[model samples]
Target: MHKRFLIIVIGLFLLFPLLGRAVDSNQQILQLRAQIEELQKKANEYRKIVATS
Candidate 1:
């Protein structure tokens, strides 16, 4: 029983860091997507100006 508990505790210690990285990666992806959308909007506006000229 003690050995089983020790293994579970060690497994969790290893798993938590991976979980934290996954959360960070998700946030980074969201930020990148937002930036891409903003840049696309600017490109479309520029296209409109060029088309008019």
Candidate 2:
């Protein structure tokens, strides 16, 4: 019983970092998507200005 508990603890310890990294990566992806959207908006504005001029 003690050995099983030890294995479970070790498994969790290793798995926690992977789970944390997955969360971090998801946040990074969201930030990148937001930046891309902002850049696209700026590009559209520029296109409008050029079209007017």
Candidate 3:
């Protein structure tokens, strides 16, 4: 039982960093998506101006 417990503890220690990295990447992706949406909105406004002119 002690050996199994030791193994699980080691596994969790190793896994924590990988989970943290995944969270970081997801945050980056979300930020980029927001930027893209903002750019698209700007482009749409420019299109309207061009059409009116």
Q: Which candidate comes out best when scored by TM-score?
A: 3
For model 3, which pairs clash?
A: none
Task: Looking at model 2, report the run of 10 residues with the lowest lDDT sum.
Answer: 1-10
On residues 1-53, what C-alpha lDDT tens digit does candidate 1 reach at each position? Answer: 99999999999999999999999999999999999999999999999999999
The lDDT of model 3 is: 1.00
Residue-level lDDT for 49 in candidate 2: 100
lDDT, each prediction? 1.00, 1.00, 1.00
lDDT at residue 39 of model 1 (Cα atoms): 100
Q: What TM-score would every model get versus the actual structure? A: 0.87, 0.85, 0.97
Q: Rank the candidates by TM-score, best first.
A: 3, 1, 2
Question: Candidate 1 vs candidate 2: which has greater TM-score?
Answer: 1
Query: lDDT by residue for model 2 over 1-53, one digit each (tens)?
Result: 99999999999999999999999999999999999999999999999999999
- Writing each residue's lDDT as its tens digit, candidate 3 over 1-53 gives 99999999999999999999999999999999999999999999999999999
lDDT of 2 at 32: 100
